[model samples]
Target: MTGPVVVGVDGSSACMAAAWWAAREAVDRHAPLHLVHSWTSQPLDVPISQDAHSERLYGREVLRRTEAELLHRHGDLAVTTDLVAAPAAQALLARGGDAELLVLGSRGHGSVAGFLLGSTALRVVGLTRCPAVVVRADDPTVGAGRDRLVAADRDEVVVGVPEPGPAAEALLEFAFATADAHGDLLRAVTVVPGSPGPRAEEERRAWLAAELAPWREKYPKVTVAERVAVGPAAQLLLTSCGRSRLLIVGRRPHPSHLVWKLGPVAHAAVRHAACPVAVVPHG
Candidate 1:
């Protein structure tokens, strides 16, 4: 919470949606908002309909309009803009390093308009130490969470706990804090080994209960539902998220290579879930 909430902005409606979501989050956290747009110029003398200059101009316009709109929406919120001449991933990673949260918009398949969750978002989310939230551009519940952050209509926050390890600490803390902030129900789901014997099932349940007991006591006001599912981790999580407004998952920051970024379940949730996904990085 020390640094401002930063959002990556391109001209795409998806980035706009991300900016709006980031703005609301900034307001909620009482942090400043930074809008970043990164671009690299085309080769000099390249023949094109819309050249680098035009693209730069358009980027500038995007920033201006987005800044204005955010200000209009939240007059008292501190909003700033930047147009960087760099790759989107590098710019976002650098900016997000010192940010409270980094928000980016995801477009599936890149067929329709809007910024797709191309390499840039995936890279930034994978490498950044800060918490990142990927908001789908086509999400129907676009600004609903912002409208009622404390009391959203669908007030269930679902988090997937893969196993008993130190990595889960950050993810669980984020889930609990989010649920507490919104005064929502917290649903923690863990996938037990399929067809476990009764003793193993009891042990798994006990471990889960013990794992969450500290958080439960700390957040006494938070209503929690602990679910132990036996199936493929991703499928069970996706099914459990039917009534959830937000899905929280954890990913370790791996080498910048594409293959090392998201774990299987987190990747699946980010790719297929209808709700927004908050990917918390844990070492």
Candidate 2:
């Protein structure tokens, strides 16, 4: 990872917030920091295209200047810039490959996701190569509200099948840490595909209880619940994730799998969860 903090920037106020947070994080982690920006080529020969194209170029230049200033401000830190020809989420995931962690502004350049957890953040959180931190948009004074971290990282025991794969472990660890640190409630949630058969629901419920039982010592106060309903994971989770301090999920084993990439549960959590969502890498 070259021991550097990697942050994705889109020249948005949110991105800058992420960059600022990343600077502090790099200092804390004693690692270098890199600021990344992305832009695609505009349509060929269109009116005002020059202005639009030039704007991204300016953004890149500004990023360079800021990178230098950040390094200068931090006595022993290093900062660099990356310009890429991909979407913000894709670039961040790729860049995250060489980072201890990835920092992101909870909100994106445009289109807020209920709060700042818009689609980009959601997609990237579960897919990033490393654990991701979504800096809250409000930046409310630390130790605000419930001041709790909800850990929802775990395999969704599929009745007879194991929780998707090894990915759940990373997610659970992030959740456990946050909960332990923030003194927040650790709400472990899993979705069970809707089954009309009462027998199937009963079996799934039993399995969830047993799975969560072993983690009691780890989370003395974690509340466990399962939603056995129809529809995709994302929609169900979005509807159920109420007041969670941080909705946690893990990277599925097969990052390239289309279903895992756009899983209903993870997508919904990223898109609509009120609080920040942490995408934990495979621990």
Specify the highest-lDDT model's number: 1
**Model 2, span 163-273: residue lDDT tens:** 634554555655655555444556555556556467866776676566656565677764444455545555555555455545665555453623226454544454455
Going through the candidates in the order shown, the clash numbers are: 0, 7
Tens digits of per-residue lDDT for model 1, 1-283: 4699888777676777777777877886678999887656222122334477777876788789889988877999998888988877777778877888888877643321233245556766677778888877666446532363222466788998867786678888888887887678999998777577778778788888998999998889889999986778888888887667678988876655454467888778878887778889887
Q: After superposition, how far is residue 195 of candidate 2 from its true place, in Å?
A: 2.6
Top candidate on TM-score is 1
Q: What is the C-alpha lDDT of each candidate?
A: 0.75, 0.56
Error of 1 at 248 (Å): 0.9
Over the full model, what C-alpha lDDT does candidate 2 score relative to the true structure?
0.56
C-alpha RMSD between model 1 and the true structure: 3.9
Model 2 alpha-carbon drift over 4 Å, by segment: 1-5, 20-34, 38-91, 105-127, 132-165, 194-206, 213-236, 251-261, 280-283
